[model samples]
Target: MKRRALAVTLPLLLMALALLGANALITPARADEADAPALAAVAQAGANTAEWTVEQMDFTSRYPQGFVFTLRATSSGGEIVSARVEWMHRPHTRAKEPISVRRATGEIDPNTGLITATWEPTQSTAVPPWVGVYYRWRLRDAAGNEFVTDEGYAEYADTSRPWQRTETDEVIVFANGLSDEMGDLVAAAMDAQRQKYLDGWGQALPYRPRVILFGDMETWLEWQIGHQDTTGLGIVRVGVTSDEWGGTVQVIYGTEEELAYGTVLHEIEHLYQREFLAGRTVFTPGWFIEGDASFYQLDDVHRVATDYVADLVRRGDLPVLLQGEGPVTFGRNALHGYYLGYKFFEYLDRQWGIAIHRQIMDLLVQNMPFTEAIETATGQSVLELERAWREWLGAPGVVPTLIPTWTPLPFLASPTPMQFGSGK
Candidate 1:
């Protein structure tokens, strides 16, 4: 079904709308998967598929409590046996390589596929989470035959054990590599991010997010895919309550080597936007969210937009800046959102000063319509803001080529003239 961005436009509309219609049938974020029981216990799957009782599962490292498990599958005819195990948490890498399959106990009946060998950890062996290993019971009945268990997702050793008080908010490195201070540093970064999330969005969303940061893309993608399977919800990189598993913010600042602190500040501003300023379902304009965040982080308004809008103006395409319509995605599509958002936000900050943005946010929370809120807060309607945005793009004042990497000058009372000014 189609969704709308904002209410009807006025006759003096300068900027074109940015947000497009989207389906709003969002889903819950938590995933709860069922376990398999077709291991050691008698189970059947269609014809020729025999049952094998799963015996044991062991984890090499830490996972979420009560969730990670392993199992041993044994054929009823004394044919085959094996273990399905889970990997401990690690960086979310998407690399694919042959797993070095080994065990100290090589107790496997080759004819029957039975093994009871326990794993021995060496100096350099890292296993990913939920790495289920299976042994097929290849046998010869009256007629030569082949068979494998259909017990999907065999259990692993329950590494998700009861938590200790000290373990709360602490690191659980499987191979034991982290120093106390390093672990604390990681904890502090996470805790600070968490607090930022809470502070920005506490009133509307009132639960702690179960945050997962992986070392590589594969692990992260796997968890997200599994989450989609379990919850029937494709994550949209938006904020969530406790149930939502994958919360994300891009670390890059559009360039190869911008300071990471700005990225953090930018994302945190989004948290505040989601919680306090915009609609729960109806997304705020991307321009506003990222722009505000960038504005807050850098504390600049004119030049940032000028750096961008000036380019467009020099190219005779200044109309893009005048389009103050809502940002299509809420906290996402950031370049389309943040870069431009930052610039636009900069212009508005210069236009109305910082206080007006705050006033606009308050008006939004009070359920004021976006256009009406702009008018009420700044005493200038959204259209006026657009005209102000357009004029700021190519004002005759000699804007220097070396726009400040620092701060922007405050906006003066320059309303749109009866006729639009031409030429830069």
Candidate 2:
């Protein structure tokens, strides 16, 4: 998907104009009666003799809410049968239809030989802040001829937030309800080790991924679509790169400094995974995805995992890593799999170097079976790999739980409250 960082600084006058445009539609001049010579000149300069021609097209306001627009068209057959304005989010690669396209309504100006129309987009849930708009004109003539203007672009940016945006060479951070210091810190953190990520992952971001951090749960929930619950869901989704889907890291507020920083890296890692496995149709396990994310965030995650998994193994609570045959990222002991999966990658890295990660990801991109990929990467059978990992962690060959037998207790009612002074 094509992406660009939009840095629109909306001033007070611009805000007033945007608001006014949203409320009213104004046609500056009669398309047919006014500027006829200019229209003719445009047609003469860039007209296809056989099709309807667009003499002029541009936006009156580029505000997300109620941006105003005007377009002028001319026809060769003296019959401009129909005209319409079509627009979708800019830099889009996944939308199947225009976000909105309404018929342009205005009288043809006889003097100017042009058809002009105005569109005033209103402020509503449909139009939000920082939305990019790509628009064009479509015209039809009586001879069944059609004309489409070259694509035009704008943004439905909210000057209200006056968002504090920071950027490094690799990533950009957009923050609302966050202090400039905090925002800059986050950006600096990303910049400090941007190369480490790009080098380790063996891929670069398809677009500059944005880290949008909301200040608190209230603001995050209010901004969210569908009023979804954001109770403890730190990171929401790395959505499609469009205004409609919002191509950014959409997540809730982070209260703790370390946790928040780690969350940012974790979500960023998710973006790398998305680009790496873009077109594959196979079901890559979640354990690998989340585990790899954890590993990326902290290189010493295997040490942490070793301690945790070792405790589990001593308690006979260590679950089988590759034998569950279900999702390992979430469940009663979900984190066990995450850290354990990190150790799995850690083992491979130690034996084969970080190159194994790229090799396994390549296998995944090819839709290869997960076990086969691991075995291929490690040069060990799946079972053998599991046994070796267990050995590396000093975990016993078998983990048999010791369920304590339950002895029934006799039911006893509390003795009636003893009289204040009579405990017999």
Candidate 3:
């Protein structure tokens, strides 16, 4: 659930992870779901004194693909018209589309006063392991009486992978065929700094985010959303996070220190954005999203972003801030927006204190315009804020005239510490 920051090093590896173009894209729902009948209207409660109820619900591993979903229910009405299971990987958020499936045909027992249904979980690669699936049951009876159950969780664990799992009060890290150090690093980072995140955001997340580190390149590539030819780039798929699978961070293995100080925290910041900041506004500018993530990272975001942009400015190559796509670009070392946005945050932090981060997020969640959100959060208009930031940066007070002639510098030889899609 973290946004990709362009401020990272090792452009190739960072690019691979940032784009997520290498992971296999599997549909989230079962194939049959596409053709499943639409849900009927909710059946109103009727004369039956005893309402329908779900007696038991559980999940068991169906390795290599999905899980076994089982449940038992009873209805006083006796004749059940329909039973369904609904689930999502993230918490406190609705699926963009229906993720409910009708129970396979079954019979209700009169003497036992119960009915049972079992089915396989959706095997879509999108439903990777370590994600806590929030699920519930819905049932309707012959008399149109309806029943619904409280939500429960099922972890679609990848039993096939040799994952070393670690848990803390704040996070869960899963490392496959990698050193325990990596898992420990991620866990410790969250354990130590979760309170800092809580303080900055002014609230806690609805659910803990999962950090998944893949040790092998092939497995990493195999799990990506699309086929990528990394032949010439020397870009080993490094890291990723997704809002789709419950704010999970998926990355190639890194040392405990690397994860503790690197993209791990950056991506976790994204989870905070979703749970606390960007409410209901599904699409915001990349500048705000990635810049906010970079600001929260363990490293010195101000210095890094400032230096990157300053260098561009010295060369007369600084692009307009709010320009096309807001700083995320495809070529080498091109995510100026990350730093530009970070500078914006830095200016806000200096003038308004860290609470401004929460304030801005609050305004954004209300679907306010970006300029208005900044003005309201900081008590200054957008132009005023921009002028102040440029003054601090020792650059011109206004956006520099954009130079159309620009090319990326050569790829860096070393990797930098740095850090999607709907379910099918």
Candidate 4:
């Protein structure tokens, strides 16, 4: 089956610092603009005990290449000795530290008190266009006095295209080669499912997520820096989410309506999973992860998946639940796991409600085993739960007895890719 998968990776923790408040001013700059400056704050004469002043602060977006930060300051106490720029893609979360705080030492000219830092793209560090970058500067003078500026924010925008943006409290939608109506449709979908997300996950994401839609494959591949093959390893990467970017980056594959309503929401659920369950020592099966994400898709997509899985149940070909390599995650019929997994969640929602869904997720967050968490939340063993779920799907309440041998694959850094939407 040709499928779109979100290849989850353990995000790198590059740097760490004391948490800062969210009240910092955001200054956006486009790369096409000539000499775009962001977050300029002139220091008053008496603002510092060391008589140091910030003359200017600026940021320049270089698009797919990289970005640059420039600082000019004067300190009467002593000549400026060192300067550093620190940035994170998203704000810090109470659940954990910020996804990543990248720090780069700036080249300083002591005579001019000028500092410059440039972040270039590497295979591991490349972020898609329009990802929010929150940053600040730290400076020290020869007198051993240090100063840290208030946080500033900017978008890593691809200014080559005519991009339309729409913002709501829940999400920010950016679309290129598409109408503003496309952005509005995505925003509407997020708004429609806001309450459902809260009910299922118990809270909103720590940061406002982004949905970047590209109208063509070339533009989409431009920012995919290191990975040039869109169809490598026999998987079609229609959409992607990164913990580092804190949003979904997608190329328009199917109809705009389906992309907005189904694929967008499905990718956002993956972000929720990363935020809530990342770094915890918990056993999250591939089926549950992808299935729960699939559950959030709109009814049209849901019905199609439901019909596919229900046919399997009725034919008594249902795969065993929670077993070794429980569901195939790659190659032909990989979507079988996703479709069947959605049914398990559908059973929960129908049998109990979204409250049970939240309860089970809460248990998993506490590092409880998946089986134990589900049993605790629904008061049913794994086998019993499977039987009930099959019955709900118009099948006899008989759990499949086939148990595939579990041959362990080589340990990978990230979990197996959790796939969505089949190309059939």
Candidate 5:
């Protein structure tokens, strides 16, 4: 599947079509309005300082390895004494301080005023292709005057492959070795849930999120440069979402329908949780996190989860939630938690409309205890909520008894693979 020569031609054709329709392209200048003030400040700072005139500035994308930033400037303030480059991922929320910013000192050519800085990917800092980067230069002259350039935006792209991209108000879809129709499906899915996202979270993501789909394993494995190989451990990782990258990186699996309606949407919801809900915090249970993400999936995906969980309810085998590890994320029946968790959110939506979800999340963000937040949102105790949710699932309105046991020894943690199909 990875060796198709058509993959090369298809992306070129799609790129040509995209160029004919300029609106289809994503413009980095359209960063969130919340960032306007900070950007304006940078522009103002650059305007007020006439000491340094930027002769040339450029950024080069060297995917799977690193990128380079170069600047040539002539400073009237005196010979440039120091130079540095700082960059951060885009779509960052302004509600808190930006913590993703990274800095590196540049090697300066004193006579030519040429400054160069390169960022090499490390085990801890590697990011997938298409991750948006906002960078700027800082310079200090011998006269002690300091100047900061306006921010520049660029994507970490792999030029080795012909990639097709599409953008909407909600998402940016990048694909290689996939049909162009897949981009439309993903964009439509995001459009379908845009209102729900706004209603539940009170706002869109501060930045346009990206979905990078790899149609073949070889392409997918290319950018995972420093990561540990888990194929020998029997783990097949289909996809992963990261707040640091501000998007989802997925290896195509199943039909494009499944990828569009379930996998892509499910992973995107994780991005929302990270942006608005603190992202898998200790106070947030795995069931709630994964289930909330599941709620956004459409078509047969939700049906599968509903049916599977309904069977568990009928068999009197519903796992106890909000206790212990709060529905296991791994091990036997690992997906049960995801299915059951979807049921819980489904129950909430059916019982009180989607507003209840926002209420619960609002409380959670306020540092309210999990049980207390749910109780406050639903006006019911944890036990009562559980019983109600079970009853809603066609079970009797009774809380299942839990047998107490001694704490088990801790074990090393492993990565959780994002599985699709079945229940998405």
Candidate 6:
């Protein structure tokens, strides 16, 4: 797999092409259309082609969005006249519209010389996200002769694409097209999480979520294993690195149309929760972890959360609402824990306002009693909160008398450490 940096600055290189327009200084006048002698010069120029070979073929350059790239080429025998570079994306667009590359073409000499063109990228709503830098350049001589080639193409990945980075202390995402905004949105979520850490609501995660995107899954996976450390989960799976607070996330492909933004937000926050509370037992179950992530992200995650809730409501499994951390494990047909946990967080946030986490965070930080903090944050204790939740779930008689228990495993002998890229 080709690995890509989760660099924040890189965006897709957009090049819109136009047909040979200005600077076709010498097209034989159509009035002279049937005049062989009149068109002979252009014919001859077309015959002895400048053979525009791209020296930059597979020459990777870091192209941030909206920058100009000057295309280069050498003419044969110093025998050519002029050269121009035209751009095209065949996968998109048709004859009706052409992509315009501003200040698109440059000049060589009237003799066998080099041709150069500049690409000033502009955003396009029509182009779908894709990997590979692909641009077909058309070259011509002063006599109106021309040649075209796609050797100028390049493929880029979005920084928000999961597992595509690890270059910093903080997670970063580089992306283009529709979802480019996801990186910062997730950053905001991470900020919320950090507040949880600061306020003592949860154990501090050692690392930040750095996201990078590719046009799709292939490149996403390609960049993923590039930095996969063998410490925890193996290839295609995120692992714990020997280093501090670090892990990876693979952003599966989707859009706002098919799934709510909550799906991505939920998974990313789960990654943080897992890594931060690594090897620590939580009195709360995984549902709370997932639910909290979803709940906190409701501005974007509401529909999906509702979907889960609705599914349970339809199934008549609503009895599990206050089932007391129902599932020790997650997603094995359990709802009250994960889904309800989200509702719990949502409930707390709504009734108490979002800032309550700040106070809860403080409780966790100073090691204030969890129940006491719940009482302090809202005049209700943990049991009172559960009772209210039961009333809301229509399970007025339900009660949760159990607290989750986690016993740390005894230290086992360490495994052999191996170097990256050294696996057999």
Local error of candidate 2 at residue 217 (angstroms): 2.4
CA lDDT, every prediction?
A: 0.35, 0.53, 0.58, 0.73, 0.72, 0.41
- Which ranges of candidate 5 are over 4 A from the true structure? 1-50, 279-282, 401-424
* Candidate 3 residue-wise lDDT, 1-424, digit = tens: 1211121223443353334222101122322333122221122222234466666877665543445556687678766666655555655332232222223333345576344444343323434566776555566777766655555666767777678888887778888867768778887777666776876777766566787777777776554445467758875446656655545555554455655665777788877765554334333566667677777666555567778888876886655564223555234644665677677677778887888887877777676656677778778766566666777777777865445564333242112111221110
Q: What is the model-wide C-alpha lDDT for candidate 3?
A: 0.58
Greater TM-score among 1 and 5 belongs to 5
Model 3 misplacement above 4 A: 1-48, 51-56, 79-81, 93-125, 221-238, 277-283, 300-303, 322-326, 329-333, 401-424
Worst 10 residues of 5 by lDDT: 1-10
Candidate 5 versus the native: TM-score?
0.83
Candidate 1: tens digits of C-alpha lDDT, residues 59-133: 232332223223345554554432322121211111121112222223444665444333432222322333333
TM-score of 4: 0.83
What CA root-mean-square deviation does each model show from the true structure?
17.9, 16.3, 11.8, 7.6, 10.2, 20.0
lDDT of 2 by residue, 1-424 (tens): 1211222222442453354332111211223233345334433433336656566776654433245556677667667776655454433332221122223444355576565555444222333345455655556667765555555666545565567777676666667776667667767666655765766667666455555665655554443445444436763432222223223434343443532355666666666665555444444566777777666653345567778777877886666665433225654777765777677767777877778788887787676766687778778876677777777777865533335465223233222111110000
Task: Write down the TM-score for model 1.
Answer: 0.40
Query: After superposition, which runs of candidate 1 have C-alpha atoms over 4 Å from their true positions?
Result: 1-213, 226-259, 277-283, 296-306, 320-337, 395-424
Off by over 4 Å in 2: 1-128, 131-142, 147-149, 225-247, 250-256, 298-307, 324-327, 397-424
* Counted clashes in each candidate structure: 45, 7, 3, 1, 0, 42
List of clashing residue pairs for candidate 4: 1-332
Clashing pairs in 5: none
Give the CA lDDT, 0 to 100, for residue 367 in model 5: 60
Q: Tens digits of per-residue lDDT for model 4 on 121-187? A: 7766778899887777777777776666656678897888789999999999999987669999998
Q: How far is candidate 3 from the true structure (C-alpha RMSD, Å)?
A: 11.8
